[model samples]
Target: MTNINNIQSISQILDSQSTKKSKSSGPAQGFESLLNSVLEKTQESEQGIQATELGEIPAMDFDIQTVSSIVTDKTDKLLTSLESYAYKLDDGNITLKEIEPMLEELNADAASLLEETLSLGEDDQSLIDIARSTAVTAKTEYLKFQRGDYL
Candidate 1:
């Protein structure tokens, strides 16, 4: 009872034809192409990240007050080390076991202070000299203690 001219054919109904041409810049059409594109983009992003990470760091400038504070801190550490030794020595019953560590600490602190103060202005010459002398004194005291002089 159907009219033949109005009836659609099975082949026409299942046709896969495109009305327009695909652009070259359109999404990749195959699995291999898609995977390759993803890999290329990832490599590009990674290169950008690497360039940023490997960039040179800028130099820092320390002002006079900052430098002075650093030097003063080192000097304070040296003085504290010397004071600890003095207190232990004044304790009147100090043993070699106690003095050994204190002497080493005083020696280290004095050496560091001397090194730091060496770069200061001529106004700090006295401080530099004091640091040097303290270092020497600490070394000598340590040597004497090691030789059983205080035993």
Candidate 2:
């Protein structure tokens, strides 16, 4: 009877292990694939933007308001993405690898915006500097979380 009970307990444990593995496997793979796709697209988009090229002042007349609006829209998207990921992190669902790439993308977006803003006339410099500084500080905190040094 004791041998039979031990066998039953072992079977229960094996069943539990298999169940947990099966449950986690699909979601884990999906999350990893999503992260990969986001990273790849972000890198491609950043390359196409070429923030350095924006540094050159074009001879043609430009609308600063239109340019500022576009920059604000991109920055808002980056911030929104980071905020969503932070919620996932708070839930203990985000892995360090996932956080790192996302943080890097956010940093790049902020840097690109700053580069474009700096290319503008001196009148807009102060506001752009403030925005850039805030973004840098936010990115630093994000990096800490990604490194598991802070929450």
Candidate 3:
């Protein structure tokens, strides 16, 4: 009876020790290997992005510069149109009726430019606002001339 009891106790101890070893062996190494693989893949993705993104970065900047150039051209056109409109209004030889159509076209062009400027990013918004205000001022001055109360 004493021998049988000792054998059962030894069997239980061995069973518990085997379970602990299995727990430390199977899932723990698997999880560590998975983590290492994920880290390796992430590093590979970062390296690939670094290789491919340099050209893309410059092209994006070029597009922004192109838009800025167009905005500058429109700004020049708007200022010139306003100047000509005011000049014709102040001239004594030219009749107001003849120049009115030209002023209207200039106003339309300015409005179109304003719409284009508004499409730009926050970096360009201040310029867009100024252009809009300038257009309004031109329109107001033209109306003032039409009323014979030019100031």
Candidate 4:
């Protein structure tokens, strides 16, 4: 009876030890391999980024002369239209209703011209100033006309 009890106790100790070894080694080995693979992928991506950084970037060529001309042309048109409108207002035959849409259009053009002026060179400043003043004058005349001050 004593020998049988001792054999059973020894068997239990062996079973517990084997279970502990499996629990410790199985997932740890798998996790270590996963971490190593992730590090390798990161290193590959870093090398690819460094290669791109060493490559030459292409230059962009553009001309502002055409753009400046367009702005100038638009500004000229705005000034012409405003001058014509001022003459029409002075003639006093056109009504506020008739002038509304035309004034609105001129105002829109003036605003666009003003925005374009910001991108223009220093030499075009006088043209910008003229457009600005013309717009303001037109607006003032329109207000006066609305208030019956012209009559």
For 1-151, candidate 2 gives per-residue lDDT tens digits of 9999999999999999988886785878798889998787767767885545335686988766765666566667766866866776686666666667667777777767666666566666665665676577667766676667843
Q: What TM-score, computed on C-alpha atoms, does each candidate reach?
A: 0.49, 0.45, 0.49, 0.46
The local distance difference test score of each candidate is: 0.68, 0.70, 0.75, 0.74
Clashes of 2: 0
Candidate 4 least-lDDT 10 residues? 47-56
Model 3, global lDDT? 0.75
lDDT of 2: 0.70
Residue 98, candidate 4: Cα error in Å is 1.0
Off by over 4 Å in 3: 1-65, 145-151
Which runs of model 2 end up more than 4 angstroms from their true locations? 1-65, 125-130
How many clashes show up per model? 0, 0, 0, 0
Model 3 poorest ten-residue lDDT run: 51-60
Estimate candidate 1's RMSD in Å.
15.4
Error of 4 at 117 (Å): 0.3
- Write model 1 residue lDDT over 10-61, tens digit each, in one string: 4454452332223233453465588887787768767774444445799899
Clashing residue pairs in candidate 3, if any?
Answer: none
Ranking by lDDT: 3, 4, 2, 1
